[model samples]
Target: MSNTASLKKEYAERIVPALKSQFHYSSSMQVPVLKKIVINQGMGIAVADKKLIEIAINEITAITGQKAVATISRKDISNFKLRKKMPIGVMVTLRHEKMYEFLERLVRVALPRIRDFKGIESRFDGRGSYTLGIQEQIIFPEINIDSIT
Candidate 1:
């Protein structure tokens, strides 16, 4: 979409220069750049109902504009009655153009619609990446309210 194009252009035209001046970066690579955006939805109930996992995958695919991959357990935990290779959640990794498009939609359209919005809690990771959790996927326009299962 055009949003992705403008985002990339803005980075090159505006953001890069600002970073170069502020940090006095000798090289463009050190200024840092966004690599990917990962959208995840965890469905613990899927352990009880396999149908729920399929439904989750469909919903995540609709939200991210990409096929969703089911996240399986790495090892069995007897306390939780969880087993290895059992579908527990669904997720999609958006990269390049898709990442920009999703981010633009999230900031511009979806987030504001959340009822009683009180800003977000963001935590940065080891590198420059950060993780943000959205409790409701219904905030995005892509998901149909009636179609929710």
Candidate 2:
């Protein structure tokens, strides 16, 4: 894919050199690169209908092209009717090629489709990692609108 090829070229020709110059690093390996893309969805309704977790898992899989694993509660909360080991969310971690592909789709396709869209915030964590939250999965072209419920 052109996106994949261009991203690779950008990293090699642009990013690696920029990092090396900025950080005064001697080896190309010292430059940081995107390691993974994590897609997560919290299934609060799973407490009422366990099947909801499966739907979230399927949605995440469609968006990321990877199967999602359930995230269980780490502790019990009596008032909230939560228990340890209860599946409360689904997450997929995309590495290597999949991570780059998903990013290309997100930046080139999905983000532009939103109404009244401004550019994304340029905020990052101290560690240089960024997180983006999408309001709906239908914004992704891979998902068929008619199939959404």
Candidate 3:
């Protein structure tokens, strides 16, 4: 087998069983289905600010109680080719029991709250991943105050 395949198989065998045990899933067959919810796309001036990223992560964690990883990619439209690096967006990966819980909350509760919101348009990124974009973060019901004391 190829090196990557071998590594993946080894990792899955070790990680899956452990995750099942840690999350008290009872059986490996009960592992929750993971869904990737992409939060933005850079067409115009998408809010790629640090504050926004923090707010998003905080809101997601608060609602889902799942830690999310946020990242920013700055637009680098130099050459005629629009192949510049842009602040893509944040990706929240929910795992184990949290995965199902988050999905339910996302579809039923969180999505409706987003203002001027439209359904996600999914497209793959060549690799085994999908991408989608949100126009604004107004959908989340999080208070964005200057100070949190």
Q: List model 3 lDDT by residue over 1-149, tens digit each.
A: 54335444654688778889889988877764344543332223334343655655565566556676655545556453233454344456655456545555566666777666577666666765754444444444443434342
Give the root-mean-square deviation of each candidate in angstroms. Answer: 1.6, 2.0, 12.0
Worst 10 residues of 1 by lDDT: 120-129
Candidate 1: the clashing residue pairs are none
Task: Name the lDDT value of residue 11 in candidate 2.
Answer: 87
Misplaced by over 4 Å in model 1 are: none
Count of backbone collisions in candidate 1: 0
Candidate 1, residues 1-149: lDDT per residue as tens digits? 48889988999999998999899998888888888888888888888999998988888888788999999999999888899999999989999988998988988899999999887777677877787878888999988999886
Q: Pick the candidate with the highest TM-score.
A: 1
Error of 1 at 16 (Å): 1.4
lDDT (tens digit, per residue) of candidate 2 on 13-109: 9989998999999999988788888888988779888988888888888889888999999999987799999999999899988888899899889
lDDT of prediction 3: 0.53
What's the distance in Å from true for residue 103, model 2? 0.6
lDDT of each: 0.88, 0.88, 0.53
Worst 10 residues of 3 by lDDT: 39-48
